[model samples]
Target chain A: MKLEKGVLLTCDPAVKQILLMLNNRQPFILQDLDEFHVVIKAELEAWVRSQLETELEKNTYNLE
Target chain B: MAMQKGASSSTSVKTAQHSLLPFLQTQSQQSLTRLYQRPSSCLSIFRLLDPLSRQLILNLLWLESPVPLSVMTAWVTTEGTRAFDDAVSILTKLHILPNPSVKLSLSPTFKASMRQAIIGGGTTASFGVPADAENKKPPSPANLDAYALERWETILHYMVSSGRGQRPREPSRGVIKLLTDSGLMSGSEAAPQITSAGFQFLLQTPHEQLWQLLLRYLVMAEERGIDLIEVLSFLFMLSTMEFGWDYSTSSLSPTQEVLMEDLRDYGLVWQRKAKSKRFSPTRLATTLTSSLPSLPTSSSSSTNTAAVASGTGATSEGFIILETNYRVYAYTNNPLQTAVLHLFVNMKSRFPNLVIGMITRDSVRRALANGITADQIISYLAAYAHPQMRKFNPLIPVTVQDQIRLWELERERVKSDSGYLYQDFQSLGDYTTLVDYARQMGILLWESPAKRCFFIREDGHNVMKQFIERRKVSGGG
Candidate 1:
């Protein structure tokens, strides 16, 4: 067994897929756990979150 | 602290207000024992205890010896065991009661001092000695009330006006220092800016706000090389003092004399002049430990019509009306209230008794940027919701509440938890066993059976490692 310290991010599988795509551009995930979870670099968790938010914001409908 | 949990559980609507109980719980046992050395501190701490704890203490106060655990347990009904346990736990934490096994009793110092406080024959004069009746022109209670309201309002108005980017009359240097040191305000001493915590402080009842400031003042006092016991005993003594009664300053210890200066800044006590030999405990000081409203309620004191006309009368009552369309109508001419509302509402118009505003996306975003949470805004609105609006179950309109929350949620898209990720298990059985063990230990954060991986909290890594090593050895055997 192997153990490593990092931030655990759990989300929808679709969100995980997007995160994987983003990881290709700039590595933030330390290890991919499964379809819905990944171990992210603790320091980059904020950056990864903001990246995901920006990505999700594009597809969302804005009334204003 | 346990008492607060018990109180919150029973009355879910009443948010836990700031009190000296939580502050005292954080003190060292030696400090707490020293605090209980005074009769006034004993009485004051007793008053602050939850009802169940007070009952238990009273039952054991005069006992010559410890009571049997079973006998004390029998006094509480089965339905009250939870509250009883909570009360006992708080008492033990405060060191008011000795640890329980087969018997329970109040601590020796606390019991003796508490007895003296009740029986009243101590030469120590833990209660203040009244000044001689030589000063024939002592301020009446009504004048003291107005003085306290003005002094307190000045501090509050300073905080509110700072948020509006305007400069009002600044409070004393000590008050400003306490405000900044407490994280209620940020920025320089010359131009302190109000923080989100300051905004929440504005919404709290005057009693809670005073306690919050005093707790911070205690911390400030400790850093200044002043005796904590002296400050705490003075505060408790002030609580027990009668409003309008002048206490001689000559009897105060040197540390308490310094504390008197700071307390005067907060309007807790009124002194005719800095060199006065005696000072009167204002309404704020007397109401410190009691359940009485710190500020004069509109219904209680009609004699303070000047206070009412000055807009201080709205301190305790609800005066806000929030509608479904997000329009906010506040029937308060109080500038302090208006400035607090201005924090999160886009003001449109103001009349004699009403202010109109709107809770818009930009307005809420502004508040959010200032570090104010959605729940704080919603609760502040709900707390001061107009009587008509309070008829609803949730107080504030559900739509407005949900919208404010959604705006806050937009900023918090991801939650992060640091832990150890366990992967590359040798077998499904090993993975399942380890996962079950982690779950049993209540340290499991996330897991995936298919991937043969799981996450355990950072603090549990050592325990999990020991478990794995033991399992390996046993399986090898």
Candidate 2:
């Protein structure tokens, strides 16, 4: 979970894969994320929130 | 990875060279000499050598003079002396070591290059350069894994689904041409079909399959006038990069830039766009130099990525069940695995999560016709056999193994080898000398002492020819 000063923290390919699948707008159940280790769960949750914010910002800017 | 049971069984016939090591070992001296110029290539080659060979190479690397044979033999335990000799022969054959009879010494070029790799003081930038901080988020490892799987599976699907009357998404033209050139597929793109070599390819381990394609790409690159040396050095370098991080493409040569495009197409890297300044190595690229067992446990099954990505604990490593009666119950939802299984199995039924198949004499013989050997199929089965079955001494049922070999041997009774026949020497001494030389070189296939003639493999013809020419020059003088 340690992120270097400027470097982005990279997740396991499996974790990145789950986040990328979110782009398809498919709803994943809790059991799905549970399959990953507890450490990656936090990272993935953070990534999902950030993805949500990016999507929300894009919509707001488009409307403006 | 499970040890190949058939490989250990002396009864099985010899399998064709399905690995990169044999191909590397057979390279001409000029190619090896040119290849040794790059430190990364030397390091990669060094890694592939036997452990004894590596230790021997290290001992000789800094030595100013050659270590005599007697001194070299004393370094290893008595039991390892034979393996030591084998290591020396392999090194000499690959031109890594010189003058085995008199003394062992590293090739000057290899010593210097390998030293440079170890000490890490060089401007070659043979290892890729890390990019500066980027604002955009790097693609997640899972996504890259998925992308690689999707892209690679698409190619396999194109090959496997050719005659099924269903077109899975086809791979690009470049990949198709690659397959065609590699002799995996034949005929026009409009109706491409898998050749027997393709079937044999389908049965190889995932790592071996990846290298086969990459090796073909290297050849394709050379054909387009790209410097093969630079391309190879870059490939060896890619195997060493950290996964999931961006590397700057600015420092790459023009040849690497083009090579990068093709690698991207093959799903080894991810770039935001064709002209992106930074690219990330996917799991495929990172696992290049890793041993078979060391590849990500989850990435073993490409088709299961979606399931695994969704946090399902399923892995692709072992899902096959082979019964004593030759019935195969493969627990696979991936079409690619199913297609590969269908190649040799008389697939009786297909379910959502399982495929029921039986290995029959006809089916195996048909596979044999397609260039897939009995040994390859048995090894493939043993490699993917169920976890329960893996605990057994022989992974597959012993009876089934013997039956498959029996089926293959029935057809193999009349075998063919295309090689050069050397005979009709002017003297017995001359014939004996050439035969002895061929044996030393390990290229003599068969010989008849009565007729003073022998056969050497086609590729070994060049070595034999060169030896005779050198002998003629020396004898004339």
Candidate 3:
């Protein structure tokens, strides 16, 4: 944890927060969920589940 | 053994007298001695400093290369010089600053914590992770709020349900045991009664109330070697989360999910069932991100002036109103909150929206007897003193205030503290300079001007020796 006697590099607060998030983040990342793109995809999964549930319910109502 | 008892003329002055700055991390309170005693989570250095101070430190934390203090002060502006200087001095005193050249930087440990805390990745895992769940419907905010308030109140109900007290319905036995274990109450008298600590805990802001409980939990968690940082980080992340947004729990660590469930009991989060993976953060969880109060009442108390334009800016709005006549009125519907106030007030009546009471010596003394300190009582009142009361500096009325202190003082006639004692200086000049320096750094404790001795709440061995060396180098004046 030693530092050079002088000179500190500054990080932007926005970037700093992102870094803090990543730093505290679990070291191991899910291969499929590591990227921001993957997170978006997972979010898409929720929507798909919602839609699928609706379709299945409609079909069940018809069958009844 | 070190006491300089006999002196020709000893003018003993409490000049350097320092009690542990109620604020943690004031060196006196930060020792390796207390480290193992408490869990690592309490060691989150940032908790001891308010957000404002933490921000000021983080801004200066990363000068990858050293920057002069002058350069740093320019960023916050001269108006913030006091804050900047205070922050630097604090960092230095905490030994977070290795050297105070013209410029200052955070200690290595602080830099690491700040970077991780800011960047959100530390080995510590201070932030909470969402829990994995089976497919289930999401819990409603109202239900979550009710759940949290009920569990917390059940804890409080246990506190107030001593044999002498009325039992409000029946709080769960588990809740009663949690209260007893937390030392907020005990089962000494057939039924538990509120301990002094319990009464004081009841009076704190929701944030502090949460902290007291969490700290107690931390102590208990210490036995099991629970990671305090991980627990804290999870709580922090929960506060920043959107109230209604669902987080995927599949990515959460087992420990994190375990914590999420515990938090669920407190209403900090909501899950459809034990098998549900995702949880929704309630107002309480969202407010955890900042120490500032986030009044959960914007759902209804929208007309409050503080919340109108600010939009939850008065997140810490205290609902206390103390009239000059020592009459206290708190506008709150939370029964637990009412019971907390009743601890130190002689309740006159309860209106639909407000509880009227007066602060008397007996009331204050009764609270003190329960193990609450006067400072805890006062600060709780100050922190939640009504918005109108808050407009005035230091808030609460002076006459009513002095009486509370007097009552506590009568309980313990002398101030009690633990710190290093220093004695027998060669000359008054040597002692005077040391005293002044310690005072400047805000660590000086007690001094006898005539006796040539001064004490600091912290040991000055390293600093004092450094001061002597610096004096020799400069040619002692």
TM-score of every candidate's chain A: 0.90, 0.34, 0.31
Better of 1 and 2 by DockQ: 1
Q: What is the per-residue lDDT of model 1 for residues B381-466, given as tens digits with 9 covering 90 to 100? A: 87677878868865667789889989898665455689999889998998999999999999999988987898999889889989
Q: Model 1 segments beyond 4 Å from truth?
A: A1-6, A12-35, A52-64, B1-18, B22-38, B60-70, B92-124, B132-136, B157-165, B186-199, B297-316, B391-394, B406-410, B420-441, B455-477
Compute each candidate's TM-score over C-alphas: 0.82, 0.68, 0.52
Which candidate, 2 or 3, has the higher TM-score? 2
lDDT (Cα, tens digit) per residue for candidate 3, span A1-64: 0101111112334323342344244321111111121111222333433443343334423211
DockQ of each: 0.64, 0.01, 0.01
Model 2 lDDT per residue over B1-477, tens place: 123555556233222222566666677778788888778788887776666777888888888888888887776798887877778888888888867888878888889889998898888776788888757777776677767776777788788877456777878888999999999999877778899888888876667778899888877877898877778777777877788788899778888888888888787888989999999887777777665432343554666554477343335678899999989999877788888888888889988788999898767877887888887888788778888888887677888988888887765322234356675677888889999999999987666687566666666778988999899999999
- Which residue ranges in model 2 land beyond 4 Å of their true spot? A1-64, B1-34, B64-66, B76-82, B98-103, B163-165, B293-307, B310-314, B409-477
For candidate 3, write residues B20-77 as lDDT tens digits.
1122243332342233122222234554554455675667667676678677666786
TM-score of chain B of 3: 0.57
- List ranges where model 3 is wrong by over 4 Å: A1-64, B1-146, B169-178, B188-191, B227-229, B294-300, B303-333, B350-365, B371-399, B402-477
Listed for every candidate in order, the interface RMSD values in angstroms are 1.5, 30.6, 22.0
Error of 3 at B317 (Å): 5.1
Candidate maximizing lDDT? 1
Q: Rank the candidates by lDDT, best first.
A: 1, 2, 3
Each candidate structure's count of clashing pairs: 0, 5, 44
